[model samples]
Target: MSLPPHPSSSRRSRLDAYQSLDSRSPTTTPTLSPPLQPFAKRVDSFTSSSSLLSLDSPYLGANRPLSFGEQKLTSSKFTLPHNHMLYLTPDFKEDDDELHMPEPKGQRLGIERDGDFASWRGFVNLGALTLVIVAWIALFAGYPIIYHFTSHRWTNLGAFNLGGTNGTGQVPIMPFHFAVIDPDTPPSAYSKPSWNDPSTSMELVFSDEFNVDGRTFYPGDDPYWEAVDLHYWETNNLEWYDPAAITTQAGNLVITLEAKETHGLDYQGGMMSTWNKFCFTGGYVEANVSLPGLNNVAGLWPAIWTMGNLGRAGYGASLEGMWPYSYDACDVGTVANQSVNGVPVAATINGDAGNGGVLSYLPGQKLSRCTCQNANDDPSKGLLVHPGPKHGDGTFVGRSAPEIDMFEAQVGGGDVPTGEVSQSAQWAPFNAGYIWQNTSTNEVIANPSISVQNTYIGGITQQATSVVTNTDQNCYEGVLGCYSIYGFEYVPGFDNAYITWVSNNQISWTLNGAGLAADAAVEISARPVSQEPMYIIMNLGMSHNFGPVDLPEIPFPVHLKVDYIRVYQRADQKNVGCNPEGFPTIDYINQYAEAYNNPNLTTWVGDYQQTFPGNSFLGQC
Candidate 1:
């Protein structure tokens, strides 16, 4: 006897095919009518014949046979063979095992036999599975094409806001690359200069054009600058650097030096520097500066210079070390005699090691002296020089002293007064001096490249001396009309050593881009060139002890108007070093203790007591 095949075999195969197809697509299973009730009732009785049905039916393939209880035959509208039709009868063969269903010959076995409803179910399930797979493939292949057309249609119709003024009257925010600028607008007028040569290309890293309106002073609540409101005692300068004297007006920075009583000092001045805010190794730095009254002022020392940033704190501890070794100072006036026009003038570039050697004054040690030409003239004397140790070769040996006086000039006659009666007989002079020491032998050496008309050395036993006078006729008279560009280019030697065969450090100047007379600039192929970073500084000082037998009275309320200060660096110089450490901040009570040597120097927190209330006073020194 034969029983019906299992219903699960056909259903499981169709379900497996559906899963193997893409799961993202929609799928459906075919619905079948309920199985014949007679077949369901006879399923238990035909368990022994289930294996035979599995082998005979083509739909079952080689699958294992199902038990009689597992087979469920559904109704079908098809003809049946006589032998197979007996299995469909409700009362067919429970006890008599002789009755059997015959397999159909030369035909799809289950389709020709009426009671083989499992084969019909399998055919319906396979067809449904094929339709689902085809639908899934169509959807997966057509999605990209549909998306492209839909997006294009919306974009062309302006349905999406791509960036234009919105209903709120503001432009929609977009990426920076898409923004546009008007071509008619001009670039910034005070922007950094652009160079055509690639080797000299400069990128402006820091600057201040002083263009801010209503700004009375710099770094005014701005973190990029720190105002220096303290006094400097290293040079024994007469003026106290007060922040109140610093102001900004007419789009320029003005530092006023007035002879007013402040902090027990006879003169009050202003000084400002970028100690920690910014510093660079080597650059072309320049400023358009106008000096104060130059007529008959013997001690007015106004300078624009720079100092090394090493070992300096941003606050009170900035000057931790001395200055000569680390500074590049440009003193605008160094006068020896009264000017022909009553206004004396000169320019001096001084570089040295700060406090490296001892400074002592000897009594009655007259090196050299010169007298005036007439009876009313005051006597002139050479500067009292320092002494050095005597050497075995009869030449005195000096300590390793390095100094660079890149340029020095005077508008009047030399130290020796000329006997000429006319005031026009006074001569304008220029000078450059340097004293370089051999690091190995400590012997003083004079630079051969610089030329001087008259040289002076050996003041007192001649330990070491250097002096150079101007051979050129043109001398700057240190006046307001002398608005010229002055700068220095310090290129390091090979391997950044102290000395090299090719000398590159030079001091230069130009009047409105036109070169001055011959021998105006100085180049020293000498040792002791500074190899450290330097920061910029500007100040007005008095009584530096440089010239004249009698100190000339200085005019009060002297104003040093600076148009701008700019720094530029070459594109290829790689060793642009900087110091990031800042010194600890000292409280007001203990400020300037080292400089004054008196622990009782007064200190105030705010810009003096006059600007703010009594609450601003930190403490008295």
Candidate 2:
């Protein structure tokens, strides 16, 4: 149905006014009509349809002419601010068009607005990420540099493993901080005589410098040492001789004594001998040694001495007759005792086998088997038994051996037995003595029924006595300091038989160029002046009822360091030679002797007196 459009009240007013103005005067202008309502809403009211707004409509309201201001507003292109009102020209045309609403002004799709605060936040995050990456790169680059300079380089020196069923574990390959030599410390202050110097007349014989380069598990493998595996020998010691306790380090032979258990014993230590390897008839032997220095702990009996190798092969069969001779430098008093018809008897023989029945036996005569003992039982008395036999025909029986004492120092609280006596504030007191069987007493040997002449005699007072005077200072001065040089010189004569000396700082001798004093020297006019080949033996033994019974507890793993053992013989005596089968090779001896030779060997003479305070006979220099 088609109907004519009705005018609104506002439109009626404008029409009436216009008619009145025309009636009043034909030339008068009428007032402008008020603004029209929105055409979109008016169109919506006219028809209830979604297509009322056409696709190309400009105003969608009335068609009116534009005023000057409306023409200016329509001529300019402007965009509407968000949520602000929209303006249209007064002369508007209707057209169908799509209205595009401006997008919301704030954030979209989680992206922030491009403002000062947002920009600053983004800049800070980027800077933080950059810093993290730079730090990682620096760490990677600098790590190798730091490690190259500061990291520790591990080595197998002075290190050993602690675990294994047989206690023979692989040596650890790690750096031992404590074992490293400090670069700032000075070297050893003392120097020993070189046997090969032209000015020196001695020739090197047998030596074990213990200069092995790599780690050694057993010292016996060195070809020059025979590790003693004996459990007990005369002395009732508490320690068992263990091969595990021996090691070579720092160019020294190290023997450690520990308070641990092994072989069902509470203590363990080491004993090494050159029994069948290298033996000498007469020569000068010395060893540079350092003892364990611990407080309150006693029962340390360390010795470096020699034993007769009579019955051994290569040695002259005639020498086997003198197999009983031994040179001992021991810590405790050495005595020999025998039980006569079930009666306990004792005597102080020092190192000599007294005029007893043991020596009375003729060649091929079997000696009566008697109970013999050493200083292990009582200082005043111990058992002495007959040494089985010397020859296969049972000739030369009994304990006719002579023992020479080189050096022995006993400390802690105990009875002072025989030998040279000295006291120290911080160390074990020292008492050294020498004894040997004097076969020169022709009157006793010539007597018939020599066994009856072997009657028990009380203590035969030693012809010579030794004293430790204030003139000689203590070798070990501090509570934990013990280092000494021990040696002996044997001359094959009754006048000045042998002289042994022990000094803490260096090897020293008396002022007369003799190694020992006239009284301290071991001299036997008749026989038993060390006429047979002997071997070297060094051991660390415990108490044999020898030292103080109330000894303090000893700590574990105490060390004894032997820097080197040097053997020398006079050039004239070197021609005497040695048994090729059992002694050191001649080539080996000559090589070492030649290597150690120096033209500056004469410089040692003056310096030797400063420490030894005596005429120097170490060399012909």
Candidate 3:
């Protein structure tokens, strides 16, 4: 800015200054300056030293020869060592163009982009897999409700069946029907004895009083049963329950099947009653009776049966005290042949339904009919299938032609029911009883206890009073059997027998039989004057010692059918009498074995011998 100086002088001074500056710089010579190049020229820059250095970071000129300018600066002219000169050179250039390294050209860039894309795809695929797994779980775990909402209102895919009561028709309940009641002779001309009557107590007992408007007894009607003392709680109390099927008549009061019999032995278990708890009474009574229908097989034992209530006696004649056993002719004790000597009454009716003998009796048989023609269905007998043959007429009959036979009887009809097998040992599943059916005869009988409460007079509750109403009307057979309890073996007659009760104080009985004397009267009175108020009693017995002593045969699956029994008496009245001696206990039994089985699993231990070691032989009683 002062004045224009001479170029030569200024240049010389600048040159000297440049020389001095170069000495201060550690690697570069100040005399050199950057050179300009065309854009196309830069394309071949790989030939440059900078390019070589960038290609490999280790290209730090460590082994490269030193630059001429650096050599000159380090050593005089050319005397410097090569390594020393190279070491003095700078590691790299700081040019703007050099600082920015260009990526490889062409295919290399494409390859790098492809690698990035592959990695992104892997991440995306993993995310999709996680989403799919979550979706699958949500769908599978909630299928129950989803299926129900889309299908049936009430699902049965997962259901339980119990007693045909699941509201679903998946369970099977055997269909056995009963109709008509009559009392006549041997319903099966194939059997013994002529006329018969219902073997059970008169339905009149269910009413406030007997029929015939409380009919007076015949002159020789001295049926007397003494009162006895039956200890309860102190001993094993026999539980008597009211039937769950039938209800008491309107006029009926609450007949106590209750465990409250007031009398000692006379009326033991609460107010017990065979009528209130009996399931069936086997065998025939001595009377020709007729039911509402005709042509019906006339079978009689007594209308006291319990598919359920096997032991329930009314206070008036509580069987509770006599529970565990009784000297009833059917159960144990010896007695008059005509005496009603059985336990509650056990019987079965099989052979008659074309299931007679052992052949047709086998399960899965095609078709079999009753031994009687009209036993299955009859217009005259109105399906004479229940009660008994019309009122004790030896004309009642059960007929059927069998395709086969359970035993070798019906094949020839040569009196087969009484073969040696008839007397052979028979046994129930649960060690209940053993029954032997007369394959040839129509007798389904057993050796029952001889005496119940030891009758003081000849007249007692036996064939004379009532006959089994459900077995063939002419109850040539004398018992009914059924045993289907939880955890207990399902015996032969248990499922097939038609046993039920419907009453607070009464037990009515009905079986598969078509003949029973409807309304046939059979009365059970302790005496003209009983304790008045007593408990009910009931049991299932397979034997009754009362019968023609000559006929000692028994039957198989013999059964007693019952519907419902009723008990009626003055509401406020109570049995007032000292009970008799202790009621029969199992200890009272004196037999080698019961003829048939009691499905109810009570009293009988099947083999009287079994009791011998534990109870009988020891005389535990």
| Model 2 lDDT tens row, 253-337 | 7877778787788888887765334556666677776665343345566666665432221122212222232222111111222
Candidate 3, 467-582: lDDT as tens digits = 11121222222221221110000011222222121111112221221111111111111111010112222222211132221112322222222222222112222111112111
Over 210-260, each residue of candidate 1 has an lDDT whose tens digit, in order, gives: 544334423323222334555666446677778678766776667788878
Please report, in order, the local distance difference test score of every candidate based on alpha carbons. Answer: 0.35, 0.39, 0.22
Clashing pairs in 1: 313-583, 324-352, 324-354, 325-352, 325-353, 325-354, 430-470, 600-621
TM-score of each: 0.38, 0.40, 0.18
**TM-score leaderboard ranking:** 2, 1, 3
Task: Give stretches of model 1 more than 4 Å off.
Answer: 1-203, 213-220, 311-322, 325-434, 437-482, 493-528, 548-553, 574-577, 580-621
Q: Supply candidate 1's per-residue lDDT for 530.
A: 39
For each of the candidates, give the backbone clash count.
Answer: 8, 29, 206
**Model 3 error, position 424 (Å):** 15
Model 2, residue 199: C-alpha shift (Å): 9.8
| Location of the lowest summed lDDT over 10 successive residues in candidate 1 | 419-428
TM-score winner, 1 or 2: 2
